[model samples]
Target: MTLNNDYFKARLEELREELLAELAVAGPHPESGHGYSTHPADHGTDAFEQTAGIAVRRNAERLLYEVERALTRIEENRYGICRDCGQLIDRARLKVIPYARYCLDCANKHSKG
Candidate 1:
């Protein structure tokens, strides 16, 4: 089945915008150090929350990188094709993960390796 590049592009673009907005909102705002209480428990809680926030931000950054790469592939006319095997990616997979770069077989192989 043929995939609709325009649809995928639009979806990816929307995701990219959302991610950017999320990052902007999350960035430049380190509540951990701001108005932190002097209590021992408050310190511990703040530290844990800071760590969790860092983890979440890192994950968002990684996903943004992947999404940007997928957008580049789309621009280059290489989207929906497996990078390793050069085969068309499955339509169902694309529908689920519009930024996928590998077919199911290739993805499975890579995961195993």
Candidate 2:
């Protein structure tokens, strides 16, 4: 089956914009309050913020990597082919996850194994 470069290109651009927005939110900032004398509640909230920010940044970085890979695939003319099976990945799956490198069957098998 033929790969749809226009469709995947649009999807990749959307994902890139989303990751950039999330990364902007996750960027570091100075501490809100004075150091080492904050209340317990404030400290707890700070810890939660730090953890959440790290998680968001990590996910954003991963998404950015996937988006880059998708763009590379488009350049290589291999965008919708499953890497493992050399078959066309389903359009439905691509619509839902444009960065997917494997078709559903291979992905499911890989997950189980």
59-105, model 2: which lDDT tens digit per residue? 88898998999999999999989999999999989988999999999
- Clashes found in each candidate (C-alpha, N, C closer than 3 A): 0, 0
Scored by lDDT, model 2 comes in at 0.80
TM per candidate comes to: 0.78, 0.79
**In model 1, what is the error at residue 96, expressed in angstroms?**
1.4
Q: What is the lDDT of residue 70 in candidate 2?
A: 91
Question: What's the C-alpha lDDT at position 14 in model 1?
Answer: 91
Off by over 4 Å in 2: 1-3, 28-45
Q: Name the weakest run of 10 consecutive residues (lDDT summed) in model 2.
A: 30-39
User: Tens-digit lDDT track for model 1 on 9-87?
Assistant: 8889998898887666455454545533433353444567766756767777888998899999989988999999999
Among all candidates shown, the one with the greatest lDDT: 2
Q: Which stretches of candidate 1 lie over 4 Å from their true place?
A: 1-3, 28-45
**CA lDDT, candidate 1, residue 53:** 58
